[model samples]
Each structure stands twice: as C-alpha cells, then as structure tokens.
Target chain A: MSTKTETRKEEIIRIAAKLFKQKGYSAVTMRDLAKTMGIKAASLYNHIESKQAILQDVILTIAEEFTLGMASIQNQKASSTEQLKALIQLHVRIACHNPDGLAALNSDWMHLEDKLEYYLQLRNDYEANFRHIIERGIENKEIKNVDIEVILFSMLSTLRTLYLWIPKKDRLSEDELSASLTKILIEGINT
Target chain B: MSTKTETRKEEIIRIAAKLFKQKGYSAVTMRDLAKTMGIKAASLYNHIESKQAILQDVILTIAEEFTLGMASIQNQKASSTEQLKALIQLHVRIACHNPDGLAALNSDWMHLEDKLEYYLQLRNDYEANFRHIIERGIENKEIKNVDIEVILFSMLSTLRTLYLWIPKKDRLSEDELSASLTKILIEGINT
Candidate 1:
C-alpha cells in the first residue's frame, strides 16, 4: 500500500477502536464507522476490508504488543518484583496511549471471527507466563505464600481494567500511576 | 399479585438475567427472552412489562442489594479491617447467589433507558461510601498511607469483577474465597 493508504488505514482503525469501545463491537457497523469518519461507506471499504477486519487488526495488534512486552520482561534477569513492576508500567503506558484500543482488546476480542482462537492462545500464554513469575516469586520468598491464582487474579483484574479508570484522570503522570499501583498491588495496604 | 403470578414473574426475570449475561442487554429481545423460557412473547408480557422493565428489575435489584450491603457494613461499629472483610464476604455471597444478575449490574446497566440516572446515583453513592471507609482507615492509621483512590480502585476493581471469576469455580466455599481475597487485597502479597 502507498504511504497515504497506510495512514488512512491507521486512522480508520483508531476511530473504529473508539466507536467499538463506546457502543461495543457487535453494535457498530461499517456505515456507522464511516459516518463517524465523515466518509461514505464505499470510501471506508477503500481503506479497510470489512468491519471484522478492522476489529481483527485493532485487537490482534494490541494483543501482540502485550505478548511481546511479556516476552521482553520474562527474558530479563531482574527479580520477580522488578519484573512485575515493569509489567504494571507496561500496562500503564499502553493504557495511557490507546485507552480505546485497550478497551477493545479487553472487551471486543470475543467478537474476532477467524482470529478468536489466536487471540485466546495469546491471552492464555500471557497469563501462564505471568503465573510463572508469581510462582518464582513465591519460591524465592519474594512474595507471600498465598494462592498464586488469587494473587495473579487480583493483579490481573486491576491491570486489565486500567483503561476504564486511568483515562478519566489527568492528575497522575504515567510514572506516578505505575508507582502507586505497584506499591498498592505489590505491597499490602496494612499499616 | 397472586403467589403463582409472583412466582412466574420471578422466573421470567431469572431467565432474562441469564440471557442478558450471555448476549448482553441490547442483543436480547423480549421475544428472545420468551423463547428462552419456552413461552410465547404474549405470555411474557403477562409477567413482565417490557424488556427495559426486566433490565431495570435485574440491574436495580442487584444494585440495591449492593447498596443495602454497604449500608449494613457502614452501620457496624467495627474497625476498618473488620468492615473491609465483611464487605468482601458480602460480595462473594452476592456473586455466588446471582452471578448473572451481578454481570448484568456491571455490564448492562448502561443500556437502561429510564432507570439510568437512578442506577448511576446508587452506584456513585456506593462508591462514595466505600471511599469514606477507606478514608477513615487512612485517617485512623489502620491502613497504609497510599493514595486512597489507588487502594480503593484496586480493591473495588477486583470486587466488582468477581462475578466473572467466581462462577467458574466449584471447590471453594464463599468463606474461603472471601478470606483469600481479603488477605491478598488488604494485607498485600509481599512476604
């Protein structure tokens, strides 16, 4: 594709993510997307294949980014605590940059037609790798002896929903947000 | 209403909550709901007024339960730690009893036409009451000196999403789940 074509495709995906985030994936049609972009549906087809294709691109791209981030964190020699903090920072940065895309990645991935299995594989792999790190932490006495699933679930649930909460705030920088989350999530709130 | 009429209404609302949990509120029609219950659409009207009314009933019923739970916790003369544990137990028990209803309360409340403002008011008040307890904990030095919002957000996010996770498990009793969550959430997982 030409540079102009690629740029338009990117813009279409961006706007589609926003629409999908608001009205959900099943409710937003190609015409709705085109209307939001101030273009005819035919013009939309010129840049994108279909609404499902746009969803596939939006969700898989973010999912792959997370997989790559996890791989990078896992290959490091840092302690589990450091790696977990890096993971929190990773989520904060991604959520800060593309809250809408993150929302789609979380909520609309189920709507990916042909790519659903690939998405679920990546999700399960990402989660397994996360659990491995928590297991290592427990073994090394760097974390508590709580049920690994419980700790993992608590942290993942918070991290997964950051897009809903973080975009509403303007006071905290990314670093401040990550630090506060790391402290509250990693360390107990007990005095 | 006669006992038989009341029982039929409850049965329709129960089945509607299940369908709403699966397909979401907008996608589930009154006809679809009646179909799920093995009845005609006309019979559905005898028990319920409209799809919106059923959604209003499902969501408001669960929302009011949470509100009442929070009120009871607030009235107790317990310490923050004790109050927080009671709050977790309350969520676990509620989610255990009505996972589909809780799911609707979380995801489908936005589709509410007439009761939107009232639902939001109840939600905002619940969160405010929760924050008040955390603020008091911080003031009394019973909890860590983290950002109140961060602590609140971390805990609330997990508690709110429990309906998605808890229903998949069959081994742990409500008391066990509540205790595990309290330990991980309140005490932090740091060894």
Candidate 2:
C-alpha cells in the first residue's frame, strides 16, 4: 500500500513498523512514534491505542498475509516444484514491498505480549504447511532423498534473511532476485 | 575444548557467552555473572577485567575460529565442492561444540568497541574468500551457472543460523547434521 492511499491508522502502523525495526518494540514509545511522524503524542494516540496495538498490527497483518498466501498456493492445481516457486515469490513480494515490516516481524515478534501464542501458532502452521509440501514432494520422488528438516531449515533461513540482503543489494531487482534465488535454492548449484 | 581442560578465565568466558545469548551482551551485568557463577563480584573480576573483556572473548574467539577454518580449507588441494562441504562441516563442528559462543558471535559482535573494525575485516575477508572460491568454481564449470552472491548469501544464511537450530534438533548427530547440510546446501533439494 502506498503512503497516499493509506488511512490514518494504516499510516501510523506503517511508520511504527519502521520505528520498531530501528529501535526494538520494547524500546519504542508513543512519543517516539509521534516524533517520527512530526505530530503530538495525543494525535498519535488518536489513531492507535498503544505501542502494543501498533506492534500487533505491524506483525499480525504480515503474518496473516503469509498464511493467506500459503492457502492460496494450496488452492492452485500445480506441481510441488511450482508450488515452491510460488511460495518463494510470495516471500519476495512481501519482502520487497514491506522490508521494514519484515524486520519488525523478525526482530520484535517476541514482544507481541498476549498475542505471542497466536503468532507462534500462525508461524507453526505456516511451517507445517511448508513441511507437508516438502514431505509430499519427497514421497512422490519430486524432491531428492534428503533430510526434510535440513531442507526446510536451509530454505527458511535464506528466505527469512532476505530482508537483510535486499537493501544493500540494489542492483538485483525483485524479479531477478526471485529468479536467481529460485534457481540457486530450488535447482542445485551443482553443474 | 572440554570443561575439564579449561582454565577459570575460560570457564567465565564460556558461561558469559551463554549469558550473552540469554540476555544480550549489553544487558548482562557483572553481578549477574557472579551470581550465576556462585561467587562474589570481586572474585569474578579476578578472572576477567570487565564485561567488555568477556564480550570480546566470547565473540572474537568464534570469529577467529571461522577465519582460521577458511585458512585451513585453502591449505587443502580440494575442488570447490570439497571446499564447500568442508566449510559446512566447519560450521557444524563449531555450532555443536559451542552453540552459546556462536550465538554471541552472531548477535553481540556489533558491541565489540575497539575490536569491531578488526572483527568486520575478518568477516569481510572470510566472505570474500568464500565468494572467490565459488567464482573459481563457476569459471572452471564445476559449480552451476548461478549468481555468485545469491549462492553465497543462501549458503551463509543457513550456516550462520546453525546455533539456533542445533539445540532443538537433538535427534541428528553432529556428523549426520554436517553430511545432510552439506548435501542439501551444495546439491540442492531437487530429485
């Protein structure tokens, strides 16, 4: 979503996500958010209830998007390799558009307070779905005879850290990254 | 090195690394260290000069290990694939034996004050050497025709996060983990 089209609350959540990325969720305050926006704390409070509210919005929105993306891929009638590519694209899309939010999701998701369990549930379900796809692929001989957790861990680590790499690497466009990553990740680097 | 052979200062550094992983390097106090060690703060000081000393030992020790690992790999007359597998094994060995130290190396290396520049120089050289090896592989038509940075980033990401995953994954032995990771990371997951 672009800044011009965002609602007041959406604007606050977006900016707060950046702040949470810069200063951890626990360290950020209402005044900090307000100062970043060039507004008074009272005005900031008008749109968001508290720092916790913004964190939930910042993290949960992206988490739900990932969950929904997984579901959408399942709805497609595609092979396991195609599904995996789609999954990579989903991450690339989110990471490209919402890098700051991705940072907060990685760094400050622990500070979700009462919502931690639900966030973890979403994450667990997401990984479960990812694992099931890989498992099915292995059973069907689409994937190689490899350890499932190793495959999952290796892929997830790279995808999770894409936020860190995406900024410093300005030459590679999102599509280039998606293609190169898919090739390097899905197709072995072996000649 | 095992606990039996470690000196008192080495024990403090090892325990401090665990503390740094649990509570970040900046948050841990000398008092907390003494309490955890079941000794007085004055006694703790007899072994280490300050928190900075412990932090430096915890992080730089691992950093230097990685640098030295890379150097040892260069001394071998091996192909790029062999070198890469050795690198993966190197990460697995360090992670399995010193998981806490790896965490400190990953998370607390930024707080290394005067030594930070040297630390970064070591990391940059390590990565440059890694990149050069892959580049040589590509030029020799041994490695797949893939983007060097993408391959580098993907492999480094997984190898770097071994500390977080090692403790939870008790079923896989060190050699098994190293072999599976070597295969999955180098050969890709495709059938």
Candidate 3:
C-alpha cells in the first residue's frame, strides 16, 4: 500500500480502537468513526472493508503483542519464577501502553461472532504458554500446588484488570510495580 | 406497592436488563423498552420516572443482590478458608444467575458516571467483604503468604470471568463446578 493508504488504515484502526474501547463494539457506528476521523463516511469504505474487520485488526494487534511478550520470555532460558515475572511485567506494560487495544481484546471482541471465535482460540493458545510456565514451576516445587487452570485464570484475569484499575497518571512506575507484584505472586504474603 | 405495580416494575426491569445486556445501555431507548414490553412509549414513564431511573433501579437491584450474597457468607461462622469458599460460591452463583448484572457492574457502568457511583460503591463494599476474608485467611495461616492485594485481585478477576466461561449446559452441574473452583482456589494443584 502507499504511505497515505497505510496511514489512513492505521488512523481508522486507531480511532476504531478508542471508540470501541470507550463506547463498546455494538454501539459504535461506522458513520461515527468516519465523523471522528474527519473523513467522509463513504471514504472509510476505501480503507476498511467492514466494522468487524476493523475490530479484528485492533484485537489481532493486541493478541500478537501478548503472544510476542510470552514468546520472548520462553525463548530465554529463565527459570519458572523469572519467566512468570517477565510475563506479568510485559502484560501490564502492554495494558498500560495500549489501553484501547487491550480493552478491545479483553472485553469488547466478544461481539464479533466468528471473528471473535478466532481471537478466542489465539487467546487460549497464549494462555497455554503461561500454563506451561506454571506447570513447570509446580513440577520443580518452586511455587505452591495451585490448580494450574484456576491459578492461570486468576493471574491472567488480575493482569487484565490493570486496564481498568491503573490510572494512567497514577500507575506505579513499571519497575517498582513489577518488583512488588512479582514478589507477591511467587511468595504469598506470609512472612 | 400493589401487586399490579410490583409485577409492572419487575417486567420493566427484566425488559430493560435484556435490552441493556444485549444491545448496551446507550443504544437501548425508552421507546425500545416500551416496544419490548408491548406498551406505548409514554406508558413507561408512569412505571419508571425515566430511562435513567430504570438504569438506577436495575443497578440498585443487582447491587442489593451482591450484598445479600456477601452477607450470606458473612453470616456464617467458619474458618477463613470456609468463608473464602462461601465467597467463591456466592460469586459463581451471582455470575450464573445474573450475567447481565455482572457485566454491567464490571464493565458497563463506567459510562453511568456519578449517577451509578452509588451502585459502584455498593459493589466495592461487597468486594471489600471478600478481601477481608482473604486478609483473615492470611492472618489465620489458612492461605499462603501471598501479596494479599494481588491474590485478592486475582480471585475477583477470575471469578468475574465466570460470566464468560461458564456454559449454559454441561456435564458439570453448577454445584460441581462451584465446588471445583472453590477447591482449586484454596489449594493450588501441588499434590
């Protein structure tokens, strides 16, 4: 695509992400997106084929980032604890950096039917990566013997909620929050 | 209220919940609600003062149910572990029976602003009840020494996702699923 075409596509996707995150998928109209983007309603058709496609692209971008974050950790030969810390840090960082895409991925895409089914599979696949780390930790007796699925679900859910709870200005510096969260995850608040 | 008035209010709340849950809050108009109820649009104003009042009443009902669920556990005399189990069970029950309310409480009401702040506070206070159970568990040595905040966040997040994960029909009965989830949460899958 030409530079102009690529930029327009990015702009559409960006605006769509913000709208979908803020207003929700079902409620946002294509005309609304066009109006927000300062383009004719018909002009949007030239760049993006459908609303679902826009949603798919926004969600796929987030899924890719999450998978990439996990893959980078897996590629390294870190111990289970180190891998888990890396996973949490990367997840929260992506969440804070891209709240719109993150929220769309985590909350809004369920409205997308078949497109969402594809996203769900990708999410499960990514989750399997985390489960693998937790399984390894359990095997090594490094972490507590929690049900892998429940613990994995709990950890992922908690991490996803940072999008809702962590205000942009008040978010603890990444390094400090990572150190604190990592310590809590690996060791219970016992002593 | 008279029996007729009570029935009318429930009917309105039910229709509103369906519309809000499926179509979203902003998209569902009073006309739509009236149409769904098989009544004239203006007729709704008699039963509920306004759309906002309907929203408030629906939210207040859900919040009340949440508090009642929390109280059911709070009223019990048991170990912190037992309280945690009750808390999980109540959460799962509410999520199953009240998926719309769960989503609204978790995601939808961000748009409702100060109007819904009262509802938000009720839910938060209910959550604090759950958090206190975890805190007591840590004090009593029932739970592992994990960061109480992270663990609390994790458990609540995991529970919230039940609205998404639980199927309408399955081999696992609600009781069985709730029991399994409670177990997985209290005892990590080590042994």
**Number of the top-ranking candidate, with DockQ as the measure:** 2
The best-first sequence of candidates by DockQ reads 2, 1, 3
List the global CA lDDT of all models. Answer: 0.89, 0.90, 0.75
Candidate 1: segments with Cα more than 4 A from true spot: A1-6, A31-35, A38-47, B1-6, B39-41
Q: What is the DockQ of candidate 3?
A: 0.23
The sequence of per-residue lDDT tens digits that candidate 2 reaches over residues A1-191 is 65567898988888898888898888888998889889999998778888998999989999999999999998898888889999999998899889999999999999889899999999999999999889988988999878899899999999999999888887989999999899888887878
- Which runs in model 2 stand beyond 4 Å of their true positions? A1-3
Ranking by TM-score: 2, 1, 3
lDDT of 2 by residue, B36-146 (tens): 989999999888899998988888888899999999998899999899999999999999999999999888898899899999999999999999889988998989987
lDDT per residue as tens, model 1, A77-166: 999999999999998888888899999888888788899999999999999999999999999999988778878888999999999998
Off by over 4 Å in 3: A1-60, A70-90, A96-101, A107-121, A127-155, A166-191, B1-8, B42-46, B110-115, B168-170
Which is the winner by TM-score between candidate 1 and candidate 2? 2
Model 2 residue B148 CA deviation (Å) reads 1.4
Give per-residue lDDT, candidate 1, residue A41. 94
lDDT per residue as tens, model 1, B29-128:
9889888878899999887789999999999998899899999999999999889989888888988888989998887888899899999999999999
TM-score of every candidate relative to the true structure: 0.91, 0.97, 0.67
